[model samples]
Target: MSKKINEKIQSIIKQCESLSNDDIESLPNYKKFKVFYSKKSHKTCDIYLLCAFIFGLLAIFTTSISYIGIEHVLYYSYDRIFSINIYHEECLAPKLETLIDIFRPITSCDICQHIDHIERISNITREEFEEKYAYTNHPVIITDAMNDWLALENFNYEFFKRIYRTNSSALRGVEDNCQFFPYKNKDEFETLGDVFNMDFDRAHMIDDDYKPWYVGWSNCDYSTAYLLRQYYSRPYFLPERSESSKLDWIFMGTPGFGAHMHIDNVDLPSWQAQVRGRKQWTLRPAPECFHICKELTFIVEPGEIIILNTNVWYHKTSVVSEDEISITIGSEFD
Candidate 1:
């Protein structure tokens, strides 16, 4: 873009143009090689032809250059080389990172110097949990926290099917009010509607020949959320001052399929209750702290709950095996 570079580009463009007869005659070899391209009879026509050829090539060049404007989504993994696209921006103001540093001095690089692993605990009082881990950016799993929830016994594939079928409003709310992540299986199930309308056996997941699918969606309706909450209660360990999210989420899938690694941009920390089957969670630190922190991986068995500050911890999940569908339900609490 400098003047020197612009001049060089113009010079290269001029060199590709056909030379005039007067210009060609100045060369010493003009008499020896009277190029047919320079014949007097076809001189004007050939110039036009050359112009057309150059314009055609330029058209292709411009088209390719314009294509770079399209948005691209990328994915990354810890300890694995993959493309990454982190898009955190504000519409009309500075980025969240800049705005954060404006108010609070960010010296959090040392936040994880002591956080070696996500702890596992049970029967913890709210005060104890808040003193140790609540909003602390440290992750932990409460092993027996969900023991009283009836969701463990009732939240299976058939229960979901029945609820959605009988409660048309809830089904409609899921489609219209929530975002559905079809993950890599968007080819077959473009919408949650299609997922529910599948054949009976496939819906029940009764056969081995069924196609693999993983999906996640939030319950958007108050009625639907209340219905689903009938089986589960707010985690007792949440701090008294903590605020719970209005939206609740469910992620279900077959073995070997789960969420991609990504950081969330949300107001509250999240807690996921592993309801039906076992799931493996892999948590990674922010890119800047990749070396300063360690990547932690663990399993959440049924009746256990895992909580983390997902706004900071890059996390992903996977069903443990082909034996059962992975089911998890949770909401965020600030």
Candidate 2:
């Protein structure tokens, strides 16, 4: 390689290592990998080095994400020669094309109760919902009907966030409260039961900060056959089902202050509803979008919900207030 190219490659690698938090968040995710090769001179080196670097990066993405358990591997530019096995389950080119389809708007369901609408029925429109329930400056004034019908007290703000940091499917903690049983049938359940030989109720309970987080599928039977058999104590949340057949739920809590940016591996749809406090969400679509949407964040009020596909996008939340409680639920679909 030429001297100039060597200097450039070294510079790029140094910059990649020195990337600031803002710099990382600002750049489109796809371009992030390119930071490895950005300073290199295109003329000096043949494509072989680039291919080698890309392969190395792919190996890194796979290994790193396995530890983080993040499934999405975003790329800025595609190269046929250097790329390894397809990072995603679907074909590479088609995956990018299908992003829009996965994130389409969430429609209202007749059977499942919509807790958000109750905030509106009190003569508050969707437009005014945020301002009225604004968690920062204002208090969430609840009507008697809302308090009673929705079982508002069923939620304990303090307890929920405590559970979230430990119980969430997103975390990579020692306690296996959130286990991944991928089989889509009854046999999978039996296999899981036989291999772990766990009591469904007891197996998922983990001591986090001296408390425990319970785990089970919404569809799983708690009353009948016991896998992790312990007395069921946590709140039972039944997330809305999809038009297909996938089952999932949203996990939101009072993130009191700063939360980190991350993605999930499970192929599911999710949304965050501002239940009690204010939350600012910074979200970026898949591939090369950090360049396009430099200022792509929206603050959510107490009642409104924001739809997000965790599989394809990366998002962060800001608290901006003390003792503020926010609730965001994830919606999973088939």
TM-score of each: 0.69, 0.33
TM-score of 1: 0.69
Q: Residue-wise lDDT of candidate 1 within 1-334, one digit each (tens)?
A: 6999999998988985767768878888877566654576488988899999999987865665576432321222211232122232112232344344344423365656577777889989999999888867778999988878999889987788777774498887877667677777655665677777777776556887877778888888899888898999999999999888989989887787888786766778889999988999998876677778888888888888998887777788888855888889989988
Tell me the spans in candidate 2 whose CA falls farther than 4 Å from its real position.
1-153, 158-175, 179-258
Number of the top TM-score candidate: 1
Instruction: Please give, for residues 147-233, the per-residue lDDT of candidate 2 as tens digits.
Output: 222323343334333333443332222122223222222222322223233333322223222211212222222222122122121
- Judged by whole-model lDDT over C-alpha atoms, candidate 2 comes out at 0.39
TM-score: model 2 vs. ground truth: 0.33
Rate residue 117 of model 2 by lDDT: 22
**10 residues in a row with least lDDT, candidate 2:** 227-236
Candidate with the greatest lDDT versus the true structure: 1
